[model samples]
Target: MIIKPRTRGFICTTAHPQGCAAQVRQQIDYVRKQPAIQGPRNALVIGASAGYGLAARIAAAFGASANTIGVYRPGERSGGRTASAGWYNSAAFETAAQEAGLKSFSLTGDAFTDETKARAVELIRKELGQVDLVIYSVATARRTNPRTGETSTSVLKPIGQSYTNKTVNFHDGEVSMVTLEPASEEEIQGTVDVMGGDDWQMWIDALREGGVLAPNATTISYSYIGPELTQAIYRQGSIGRAKDHLEATAKQLHEQLASGGGRAYVTVGKALVTQSSSAIPVVPLYISALYKVMKEKGIHEGCIEQMYRLFADRLYSPNANEVPVDEEGRIRIDDWEMREDVQREVAEIWGRIETSNIYELTDLEGYRREFFQLFGFETDDIDYEADVDPSVEVPNVSA
Candidate 1:
């Protein structure tokens, strides 16, 4: 079936399989071309189908030469519809790994569930023996707590007081003020429950109990602390409360793993045109401006570049033990994004950006293209009008 891009606000409901495969190949090619990393020999990436999670897996496998197992819940093709972009991504990744003679496996299920944990443990024990690196990068709007049997849905709203900000409809470059009411206590807690580090902690505990975690393992999770421009809707919002919990969990996990020389870290990344970021108010506009500045300055780093740097430069350098971090003890890969020059220029753009000059002043076009690229659309390598199979199988899906 020939597939084209289909979209609702901030989401592409349809994905092109061949295009996804091409994008995966491009990432793998990029990693292979760069200097090899002295990182993990075996890795497990929870939420390993898209975004930073997928990029981390590629870097570990292609750059660090690690065997990797990925865990994700992606939609399957049904009723003549295409599978989720993540599904095709995993399929493409597994195929590339096989070609490269790297051991790669995909496990599809809810990463929050006990059953998925058990399955992962079983897979690790049987295939990789132990994983020295574990990356927690799950992004979801809702989560069902295995311990409590209750579901929590996350909301993107500020805390304490309402927030009003200039936001853009990236589709048409319409700039307008968006006012969001503050989240209630229940809503704030719910967001924390869904996006917090509880699931990450549980995964670590299960891995340790199952003896699939290497004694000297290093585990990292992704987070974002944008500049003051997006602080209210992001870092100081309901999601921010959850991230605070996540950072706290990193500390606890560090203590818990310190006995065996393991480490836990939160790597704060730069804002990009990810599916999740596109959903947040004011972020897309901010990212559009940031992208223009960074691209012009030649300091732009995408997920693949960021993940490779995290492994080579910070996590496993010659002085790996002395990883540089902020006062909060978290790695700041957002260094370039938060540079004084970048933020100053972005602030300048924010002050006067409106519908009329948004296109001229920002990289909204680039932002839109990347957003489509996330769903395997608008890619340069594949013909969208050509017929392709939507039922592509991930070569190494867990039995």
Candidate 2:
């Protein structure tokens, strides 16, 4: 059975195994070409199959040469349907890591559950003993409570009032105004439950109890703070409230990790095209404009580059005992994305942009390409027309 790219709404329903492997290889090659990082020796990356999570895993294995355990939920082959992009990505990642003589493993299951957590800890104990770094980069719409069997689905609506903004259908380059209603109190809380740092703290507690975290271990979760253009629907919206809780949990967890001289922080990352980010309203448009400006300025950084920088500069600074942080005790890698000149130009384009000139005025074409790349389509060198097996094994994981 051959596989190709298919789409439904913001999600690509099909993925190419070879294409995904190529993408992972590109990222690994980039990391290998750079100087090695004096960072974590052992790492665990939750949600480690796509976007920032996947990049974190690659950075840890290739950049830091860290033994890594990546925990993610990936779709397996069903009949003729293709496996998810992450499945192939993890497969490629595990194979590459092993070839590089880096110790790494891949676990597939819901990271929000007690059983999955236990399984991960068991792997960490048996495979790597303990991990010095944990990267929490989960981006999902829903989660189920393992203890209560309660299911919570998160919404990306505004908090207090309705939000109306410019949005784009990246597929057709259609730009239009989109209005999102405010979220209910319950919905807001549910978003917090899923996206907040509760699970992060739980992971820490479980690792601590299982003695799977090394002394002076450091953990970081990714967040974002876009400009005022997206403030109402992002930084100041329902997701923002969830991020606030996540950020606040970092402080609490930091104190808890103090016993082992460890630290916890939330690092705000730049907006980029991803399976998760493409679903967020208004962000695609904002990112399209921002990408155009940043690319012209020659400062565009994708997930791989951002994770490389985070590991090389801030997370593993010469002063290992103290990582550089903001006044609020968070790391800011969105510095370039949030530059005054970039934001100023993005805002200008955001105000007067339209569908007729979207291609010329903004990087909508680039955004579209990245969107396709997320699902293993539009790759430069892959023979998308070739016949390929839908069932590609993640070398480190039994499938």
Best by lDDT: 1
Report lDDT (Cα) of residue 148, candidate 1: 94
Give a tens-digit lDDT track for model 1, residues 1-399: 989888888888899988888888999999999989888999999999999999999999999999999999967798978999999999999998999899999999999999999999999999999999999999989999998999999999999999999999998999999999999999999999989999999999999999999998999998899999889999999999999999999999999999999999999998977888889999999999999999999999899999988988899877666889999999999999999999999899889899999989999999988999999998996887788889988887973
The CA lDDT at 38 in model 2 is 88
Give TM-scores for every candidate, taking all chains together and pairing residue i with residue i: 0.99, 0.98
Q: For this target, which candidate reaches the highest TM-score against the unseen true structure?
A: 1
What is every candidate's alpha-carbon RMSD to the true fold? 0.9, 1.2
Clashing pairs in 2: none
RMSD of 2: 1.2
Q: What C-alpha lDDT do the candidate models reach, one value each?
A: 0.93, 0.89
How far residue 232's Cα lies from its native spot in candidate 2, in Å, is 0.8
Please identify model 2 stretches exceeding 4 Å from their true place: 319-321
Mark the 10 consecutive residues where model 2 has the least summed lDDT. 1-10
Clashes of each: 0, 0
